[model samples]
Target: MDTEQQSQTKSEFEREPVPKSALLGFKSFIGMYAGEHCAGTELMLGPLFVAAGVSAFDLIIGLLLGNALAVLSWMFMCAPIATRSRLTLYYQLEKICGRKLVILYNLANGVMFCFLAGAMVTVSATALGVWFRFKMPGLNDLYPNSVGWVVAVAVAGGLIAIVAAYGYQTVAKFANIAAPWMVLVFLVFGFVGLRQFIEATGTEIGSLSDVWHLAKTQIWKGGPPQEGQVKFTFWHVTFFAWFCNMAMHIGMSDLSVFRFARKSWYGVASGAGMYVGHFMAWISASILYAYQLHLNPADTDVLPGPLAYRAAGLVGLLCVIIAGWTTANPTIYRAGLAFQALSPKSSRFKVTLITGAIATIAGMFPAIAMKLLGFVALYGLVLMPMGAVIFVDFWLIRKFGMQSYYAELSGKTFNWAAGLAWFVTLAIAWVLVKFAGVQIFFVSLPGWFVAAILYIVLSKFYQKKLRPDAVQ
Candidate 1:
């Protein structure tokens, strides 16, 4: 090559650092979504839907519509931005929101991600408890059930944390390898569960109506939530389906993942996760739970390990264990990325290890995973505003005659407008939830709108005072 061409190539490589690009094709995401979404937590979340009194129609229809919305959000909103920027969410946020704002955001994002992973760890450990013959907790049980349970959780958490610390490539590879097996097991579990239910109830289904009748009567019966559980209605199911992954979709966290897509159409790949993991797996798990409840109406433990073991023997148990790890591995990797952004001096590997340690501790408390439905809603709400800021700033700011990435351009230590917009919007949303008694599930959408509007207004005013040179 000519000297000029070589110089240009070297400069390009230096400016844009290259990380491993082991994730290729739609299959990687297919495995990831299926493996990550059809997880041990599904065993918990699906039962919670039943406990929340979601009717058959609402759960089925709402998931279809809501998951479609999530897919669209990724396609139109997140992927375009990600492919254009090709940076992790933290780095992108740092450029626009500045170091001070991103530090706070990263801390919150990392903690929430860790806690979420910890919950997955908790889910897997419950399965291990069955093999160890230790006492396990019920749906209402929040604290650790036994010393053996705690030890199992610790061991599982440590293994998952180590894998996560190795970084994103390993996490994706692990998911891709485990996903197909897990998906098959979940499907088999569903079929076996339905057969068991049919035998017990002596019901025969030959039509759609029959399935619906059976689902309402024997599966997801619309009843009052169990003790300490919140009631759910049609709206609750709809909103929960939409916002459960609010961080990834509405919050734009998937900007990191989608950034690598060869085309925006790759966003459609998310459907693999939503339908298989969230929809089919969720329903399958609920079937298992319903059967469990039918066998012993008084039993309320929603542990996936025991549920799967009862349904499909050792294979089911192994599915839960591997599925939980597959999900938690990526989650912990994302958490590590968030934390690593806080200290640029720290190696990503070391920071990830430390982040995993935090996740392991959080896993020790089953409350996070056990109360996952509510916790997921809250976690999504917390991180979503910054996502809104990124979204509005990237697409809308230039149209409004304001500079994008103003923090980097102006050399500002902190961008008050971005920081204040996130906090103020969240504060208002919190007031609506706590003081006005609004449902938590509905807060994220409105909060996103509030953040978007506030950022535009704040950016206009904040930029007006800058010197002529700073405007560039």
Candidate 2:
């Protein structure tokens, strides 16, 4: 086949392994990651650090360590497996977890992605709220409060969905175009916010040390959390930074994204996103929020639209909308893939549109976006066990004298071992979070180990009993 035909074939190859001829260069991934990670959500997350009462040292040091760990997880844990298999996470899961079990996982993953996209839709809609002068939901609001809010979300969500339905290359292209400008705008938010803070406090800045001192005293001053926020420590900041994208990295969702890469080392491209989006964008956003609080403590609403507008006027407002779009496009695309896995013969474009509609509806509810910190933590926890299952199945199952891809090898409709590992691990996580007083943020780390161990032990008994004679 010609290169064009091969590229087209690869784009539509949902069930089959991606051909080597269709693999993408490292630059494609870098652009995608930078654009996707430097997202609308950073607007929410940065302000959230201020609300959580994080100190400067804790937030900075924590993010550095956490983001580094996150990049490493992508490189070592996810990318290698993706390059070797050249299949979507759904397809790979189907081999080990079986068709029925994979359907459940895909549903869980799809719903979560939809909600995440919905949150981004909400962020973008807030930008509209600024332009239209509408009443937006507050930090504690659970539902849409006004007709304008609903319309804004609907319009933004519709456009974003259309872009996402065009597929990954389009998504990457859009991200590449927007990423550089969005990053610059985010930096402006920081500089503008710092100037505002300095002017307000009459603080004279002479060097980097002065800025650090200002950041410590004025921006991320350590104290009690705002109303309805969890107190943030260094560990909380670190873990939140690391595991915030746990579903993508540690949970193996990015297996789909990385499968198109020319090399496993392309995973390192994730550093662009981690540093630019998760680090710089986050800090800049936090500065903006801190300045807002400095101006009016009672204006506690965490709206990215108005916040950006206060700093850079119309350009900032435009940044909020595009930032949200860049993030949501890829997210909705991922969700579409998850849903498509359930009905392999279905039209991807149509499925993606439907998924986008669901996300738009969910976006009308403000609670998901308002409670995003907890929500994202829960999102990762819910999906992380399967990652452990995938890890163990791919690397360890054979070493333990059991057949890998047990479901595929045995032609089973469901693999009880993988299923139990997923379900039981969640159960354990729930127990730890509910009764053991463990915070949700910290539970997934130990839970990953639990899932891995459970998968290994359960697979042993399962393979022995079901296929004793076929044991390798």
Candidate 3:
């Protein structure tokens, strides 16, 4: 192979199983998950929970259970398949869903990734607004409020894309470097916010009970939601915490990440992220936002830049920027892989750079980030059916008297069974959320079972029609 060809092959193990030599140790995933999960979203989500009227008990216990579930899903649902197959989710889907159908899935997956990365960019940009004294968007504000905000997003997103275009090892290295420092900064935010609350409320810090008392009465008071915010209960908090990263864990997007793992058990490293980022970081951030609300009720904006700065000063601002960058880097890399899967001939480096550019453009629009609570729920729901399809195809299809990887075995360009399982499950999810009055956050739970069953039943009929002799 020429030098150029070698570089392209090294871009990612796109069309092939990752060689044994390329497999990563457990620490890499620990760092990556910790850095990625304890990120810009934490700043937004922590605040959003308060906006949604989550009580102290609900937020605390709910996050405990929800994060535990998220780790298990990553361990059992995603990592087993990733380690066994050592293939990217896109490539694995192509084997089962066929080339044409996989293209549709990739497009959806990649676009969602771009928008998500864009939200992170918006988060980082908010930090810049504080320094430059630019007008930032409000909780309900959708469009770019100032030219400075746009420029900030562009700079942050551009740098993130360049790093992502270098590929996975680089992404992991960046995460490792940032994770420890970011974790400490987040802790400081909690302490600073707690001190402010204590001073303002005149609460005596006698014991843990006092802290709980402060948390109950002042921080998360269990009141009605702000205008336009959804009311959140314990179930809502638990489900949101569990399924917030549903796309990455249950939706099987992390197949690309975990495919590099030496053992499926490495999935447990997600706990480092779940506990530190999702649990501690979220509580800390919510503390800052809650303090802001305590001081003034009318100021109902969810801006991380100002929120962090108020807690830790310049250090807090820097944390917000770096946190967003670390998260966006791997996200853009994954999005690039999804896009590259569509046209295997395209260069992943270039595709990633382009993908980052798209995310940057998206970051200029505040709608996705401002309405992040709903958007994250919807993002996971749209992609989650595919995960169910993957789960069934891997573990259940053969037991049901059907051939697995039907598209690959039959040389078909489109596997209608897999395609229908994806689309039909989504259709049912829509019905439940639309007319049946199921919130988007909760719909994905039942939807997963529905997709699994749909895939099995549809595969039985599909295989019988296509290859009668192949069906037992």
In terms of TM-score, which candidate is strongest? 2
Question: Which lDDT tens digits does candidate 3 get at residues 31-116?
Answer: 66776678888899899999899999999999999999999999999999999998888789888888899889888989998999
Q: What are the per-residue Cα lDDT tens digits for candidate 2 across 1-472?
A: 1235445755687688888777888877887787678888899999988988899999999999999999999999999999989888888998888899988898898899999999999999999988799899987789899999999999999988887887656766666677789999999999999999999999999999998999999999989988888999999999998999998889998998888887888999999999999999999999999999988988778899999999999999999998888789878987998899889999999999999999999999999998899999999999999999999988988898888888877878799999999999999999999999999999999999999999999988887544444445
What are the clash counts of all predictions, listed in order? 0, 0, 0
Candidate 2 ranges with C-alpha deviation above 4 Å? 1-9, 12-25, 162-172, 260-263, 344-350, 465-472
The best-first sequence of candidates by lDDT reads 2, 3, 1
lDDT of 1 by residue, 1-472 (tens): 1223323433443324223352245555554555556776777888888777677887888889888888888888888887777666767887888888878888898899999889888888878987888887777777887888778888999888877776566666667677778888888878999889888999988997887788888887878877777888777877887788888877888876665566667888889889997898888888888888889977777889888899999998888888788888878887887787778789888887887788888888878877898889999899888889999988999999998888877777688889988899989998999999998899888899999999999999997644457564
**Model 1 error, position 55 (Å):** 1.3
Candidate with more favorable, higher TM-score: 2 or 3: 2
Clashing pairs for model 2 are none
Candidate 3 CA-lDDT value? 0.88
**TM-score ranking from best to worst?**
2, 3, 1
- Give all TM-scores, in the order shown: 0.90, 0.92, 0.90
